[model samples]
Target: MNNDFKNNAIRGPINAFMFKVLSGYMDRLFGKSKRQLFRNHPETVVEIGSGTGANMRYLKPGTTLIAIEPNIHMHANLKKSADKYGINLEIKAIKGELIDLADNSCDFVVSTLVLCTVKSPEQCVKQIKRILKPSGTFIFIEHVKAQKNSILRWIQNIMHKPWHWFFEGCHTNRDTKQVLELAGFSSLKLVSYNLYSPFIPIVSQIRGRAIK
Candidate 1:
């Protein structure tokens, strides 16, 4: 296997375990928000970093779902999840930074817990803007850097390197909300929230939509 596959192989189980451990709380916190957004009922949707197809249940039937994910090991689980959820799925083995779709081809672009992990959050948002139709919506839920000068913030800064290595490039301190605003979306609305983490308050998150 190649280096990329080797890396994915090593990280995939960890990711799976992490998700399993966190999924209950994650679903509880964000499940209603996801359902409400998908109720808008966009026909063509593109989801970035669709790990294990966790968002599949939020989509409406007959919706065309374009799933962009690069990790080979996640594909089987993702496919199974898609099938179980009855999603009209189209899988793309690609990264967010290098989306291979035509401009203005998507009605809705979605990302869940993924912005912090992309190679370039700026580039990924740019591609999201590029692929979205003029009136399309971009929906996202992302972890972000905590309040400046706080103890948790300091911990996030100190732990950034090891966290990146262990989590396969997921940055614990990304200001993802700022990145979305600076990406030049026509209208942006984001709300900062927190997940229930036992150890630290650094699990600061933002979720909302931007119109292109």
Candidate 2:
């Protein structure tokens, strides 16, 4: 087998396992905000980086979810969660940066903690903009860089490299708010807050909607 493939084969399972184990705790930390932000989702929705269906609980029963999750290791658990939630799941094993969906075809696009891990946040946002219908909404909840010159920011800088490697490219200090602002959304509403979690690097978070 190719060395890269071999590495991924090992890393993928570990990451998936970690997500599974921590999903509940994470939900407890962010669930309220997610619930508020995920309200009134369309019947059909596209989710970028839908790992293990962490957002499934917020979706209504019988919702059609097109999940873009590249990590095959997460598919089985994701499917299980979809079934539990009564979601009509369509798994697309693809990256967020280059979605296969046609332009202007999606009514709603949902993402949770995704921008911090995608290879290119700019390209992913551009793709999201391209696919969303006129006046469509892109809802998101993402962890981002802490206040400048703060203890959390210092910790994020110190732990950046190891955390990125261990979490499979999840950046501890991405300026996702700025990214969304520059993405040219017709209207954007974002609220920043600190999550009181043991995971210090990811405590700084923002959640809101951006209209296309």
Candidate 3:
């Protein structure tokens, strides 16, 4: 527990409410496409910044799971989520972009709403790409700057400060979709979208198969 109060306390409730909103619309939000992402579950799934295990419900059984979270304060909750779901979750108290995992060792790497806060998301993306075995996939669900209306952009910019104060480093203006692509995601399957009061706003889930 690295004392990420930004997540455990302040952002925690926000995260809970956001998930509650999504839990209701999960089917329509994924619309069978999530199945595609899970079809070839890797032997081990390395998830970066797995906050309080909100993703537990989506995990398939028997897969080895490793979660990277720097916030010591929120570690327990993340562990609890895994236990509740019967997931074999491993915790890395350090950053995900610098996972101790050997190069090309993991079959899959994932991140969920976790990238926006990374001090260096690009480096983390590179590390994810580097650690994944050849042809491995990186699955992610993250909030990014909207591609649709500019009003959303304006709103994000305006509320960005309060959002960060409440949720640690969460930013409302990152363009995560483009980041993944630029970081070398050749194939992309966007899973869902929705507007916001929560910056969980219309996320773009990336399930990219490494071409190298």
Compute each candidate's TM-score over C-alphas.
0.90, 0.95, 0.77
**Tens digit of per-residue lDDT, candidate 3, span 92-145:** 878755778888888877776678878778888888888887777787767778
In model 1, where do residues sit more than 4 Å from their true spots? Answer: 1-7, 199-202
Ranking by TM-score: 2, 1, 3
The window of 10 residues in a row where model 2 has the poorest summed lDDT is: 1-10
Clashing pairs in 3: 1-72, 2-71, 2-72, 3-72, 194-202
Off by over 4 Å in 3: 1-36, 186-212
Q: Which candidate is the best by lDDT?
A: 2
Clashing pairs in 1: none
User: RMSD for each model, in Å, please?
Assistant: 2.6, 2.6, 3.8
Cα lDDT tens digits, model 2, 9-110, are: 777889788888898988898888888888888999999988888899999999999999888888999999998999999998887888999999999999
Candidate that would win on TM-score: 2
Error of 1 at 45 (Å): 1.2
Error of 1 at 170 (Å): 0.5
